[model samples]
Target: MWVVTGYAEVSTALTDRRLCKDSARLRAIIDRATAARLDGSRVAETVATDMLNSDPPEHTRLRKLVVKGFSARRIERLRPLVQQITDDLLDAMVARAADGTVDFVDAFAFPLPLTVICELLGIPRADQRSFRAWSTVIVGSSSRDDLRRTTTALGGYLAQMMSAKRSAPGDDLLSDLVEASDTDDRLSPLELVSMACLLLIAGHETTMNLLGSALLALLRHPDQFAKLRTRPELLDAAVEETLRYNSPAPVTTWRYAAEPMTIGGSPIATNDIVLLALGAANHDERFPDPDAFDIERQSTGHLSFGHGIHFCLGAALARMEAQVALGRLIERFPDIALAVPADELRWRPSTIMHGLAALPVRLGR
Candidate 1:
């Protein structure tokens, strides 16, 4: 495995066609060593065909099928809805804070984005609970059995959902995806299911972490937090700085070497998995005083959303969601502080994402 941490090298490797997204090559490597039964499995079908694991033509087609729904204009229109959701969650947090403490992660951070994504995907609000376990395992599976079991279940649920969407199409994005699969014939059933899983899971989880981490960053830097409270225009910078300072997705998903290639003077053999450390790259010296959490810092060139064609599909939505959530949070709980010592905070153990397990806070009583 080749790990690229330098900003320049990570950026270069992102656009390099030599580094492929095909999971089969990497799976072959694992299968050879462990004798894992991956071939002809439900997990294999979903992982092998997802847009995140395919090269051009396939990726291009798959991405296009759903890109229109996430367009800047489309996402921007959700601002009012996002603000409403943030306000509702904050109201609940304030009510809970009557006792002088509340778990921000559960009350606000987790639910805000989760609600938005579920509504966007046309998933029933009641059924959203099933995703927590499945998504956690898919992103941070401890073993092959865990991965296989969770993926099989997730794939099955998505298949069932897509079937219902076909019968009763709606204004939601999943309905749009179903139309593309049935009428336009642009997406296969498996591809549709995989896309739903990818969009629904990736859509909310990363943003949830961003909300949690961004809030944690502010609480740690009260000066910066106060500065933002006084200067509303700095909200964008605060959000950007938070993403650069403490990235939500710590690393880009695995990219396999399609052929022999040299990245940042380091030679890589074909089929080696290339992991780009986004958090490390974001703090590279290329950006002056990278460690400082200066919201006013100009030129925020972070790979938190990645670079090249595979750049996050929901970047605009995530940005909008964070901007709204953070601004509303400060407005709602002006004196919010950590309920426990900062050192006591725990982080979720996932290589691909960096997020606190819970953000306990004293939303001023």
Candidate 2:
């Protein structure tokens, strides 16, 4: 894998048409055995057919169809609801920490975003667990067999959900996606399932990391935490800084060279899979003391949500969720601190996602 870690190269790689996102084209360049392995699975094919896996005009069509549902106005309208969810989850965390300590990840970080995304997608509360389990496997699982099995199971569930939506539509994003039909163009059945999988998984998973990592960052930097505690107005800066300090996604999904070209002065090659390290790029020497976590730092030009067309669709929602959850938690428990040594905390085993496995803290009274 040709890894591009410099910010300039990563940014250029994102918008370069030469480095394509077409799944079929990418698969073809891989070893024939691996390509066959991926192609052999129906679940893989279905999930790979979505906007994230395609290049324009297919990507353009899929994006246009989905972007309407996540307009700025619609996302803004969700702020009150997101605040309510955050408050409720914090209330529960308070109760759970009657003993003065609790696993923050279990009580707050995971559930907050999970609940928001489920509600946004109109998924039943009871189904969130299954989806979570499936998503866990798809995102973090190392075993190929396990990944394939969970993806197949998740795809089956989405297929059923889409069928139900067709028979009886609702006022959710999925319904909007289901009912969306363009001028002689519409999302195919597999494409719909793929899109749902993408949204459902990406919606909560990325933000879950953002919340977890942001909290962890604050806890480690008490000075910055206290600064934000005093000036809640710095909440937005804190979020941006956290995104840059430890990008929720350490690396973006792989892109392949469609034709021979040079990157970072490297030799040209067709179909060379390039991995852009968002975390590394965010901390590149291009920025002054990039490793230091400073909310006051100007955090523009970071590749946290990526660059160009494939930038995260739910960036606004993710920001809102993190802002509300972090702001409320800190406000409610000013004395909160790590329950265990900082070094004891374990990060989730994910090369792509940078998140703690659990964040244990004391909710000082």
Candidate 2 off by > 4 Å: 33-36, 181-185
lDDT of 2 by residue, 58-84 (tens): 999999888977789988888898899
Instruction: Give, for candidate 2, the lowest lDDT window spanning 10 residues.
Output: 31-40
Q: What's the lDDT for all of these models?
A: 0.86, 0.86
Q: Per-residue alpha-carbon lDDT of model 1 for 1-365, expressed as tens digits?
A: 77999999998988999888866666776566565556666565775578888889798999988899899988988899999988888888767774789999888888888889998899988887788777777777357778888888888888999999999999999999998888889887788888898898889899989999888888899999899889989999888888999999989888888789898898888777889998999999998999988888873689899888999999999999999998888887788899999999999878887888898999873
Per-model clash counts, in order, read 0, 0
In terms of lDDT, the poorest run of 10 residues in model 1 is 35-44
